[model samples]
Target: MDRQFYIISYDIGDPKRLQRVHKFLKDYGKPVQKSVFECWLTERELESVVSWLADFIKRTEDRVRIYRLCRNCLQNVEFTGPVYFAEEPPEELIL
Candidate 1:
């Protein structure tokens, strides 16, 4: 495996707060699931991003889950460019 991306998920309490987090990660990562994001990061970058993710998650009232993956662990990763979410809700939930 050359480079790998991690799939991180968040179970948010409020639809509003969940959207906030989804936006944050989208600006920095890729949104795979509704509230789950996939990011391709180097080891150092991943670690730093995870730390930042933890801080972001802690700020939310929702339950957040992150999965940091190795090259061998990924099933399918569509390398979409960085995503930036809106302040308002998405027109449709990407489940």
Candidate 2:
């Protein structure tokens, strides 16, 4: 399966909701900043994430943005500080 890179950022008005959103995103991506994440996902995964967010957040008070990065664009990403990339879990084989 092919995965595309994305930047997901959000602003939540409530502290509880902010924590919930952050926790939920951690399952999918790496946290690049306090409210920003870097994710590599398939189309279905992305759609599911957005769908979940649509139903969870307040339409008027919370804001979520997803930015897709092409291979070329991802190559051009520049940052000065220490950066972390998400590591894939090791595959387990059961005998």
Candidate 3:
């Protein structure tokens, strides 16, 4: 399956919900910041993430944004200070 890079960021009004969202995202991506994540996901995974967030957040209280990064965009991403971008995950890992 082909996967694309996504930058997911969120703001939650409550601490509990914020923690919940952070924990859930950890399963699917790497945290680039306190409330920002870098994920490489297929279409199915993206849909699942969106669906889960849709059901979990309060529309009036929380905000979530997912930005799809194309190959060119990913290549041109810049960073400064101590922060770095997430690397692409390897396909088919055997343990």
Please tell me which predicted candidate would have the highest lDDT against the true structure.
3
Name every residue pair that clashes in candidate 1: none
Residue 73 of model 2, lDDT score: 87
lDDT of 1: 0.62
Off by over 4 Å in 1: 1-4, 58-60, 75-95
How does candidate 3 score on lDDT? Answer: 0.93
Order of quality (TM-score): 3, 2, 1
**Alpha carbon deviation, residue 63, candidate 1 (Å):** 1.7
Give the alpha-carbon lDDT of every model. 0.62, 0.87, 0.93
Predicted model with the maximum TM-score: 3
Sort by lDDT, top down from the best: 3, 2, 1
Q: Candidate 1, residues 1-95: lDDT per residue as tens digits?
A: 23355667878777776777787777556676687776765566666766766776645466766666655544344447854321222234457
Instruction: Name the regions of candidate 2 deviating beyond 4 angstroms.
Output: 87-95
lDDT-superior candidate, 1 or 3: 3
lDDT of 1 at 24: 72
lDDT of 1 at 44: 66
Candidate 2 structure quality by residue, lDDT tens digits, 5-71: 8899999999999999999999889998999998988888899899999999998999999999887
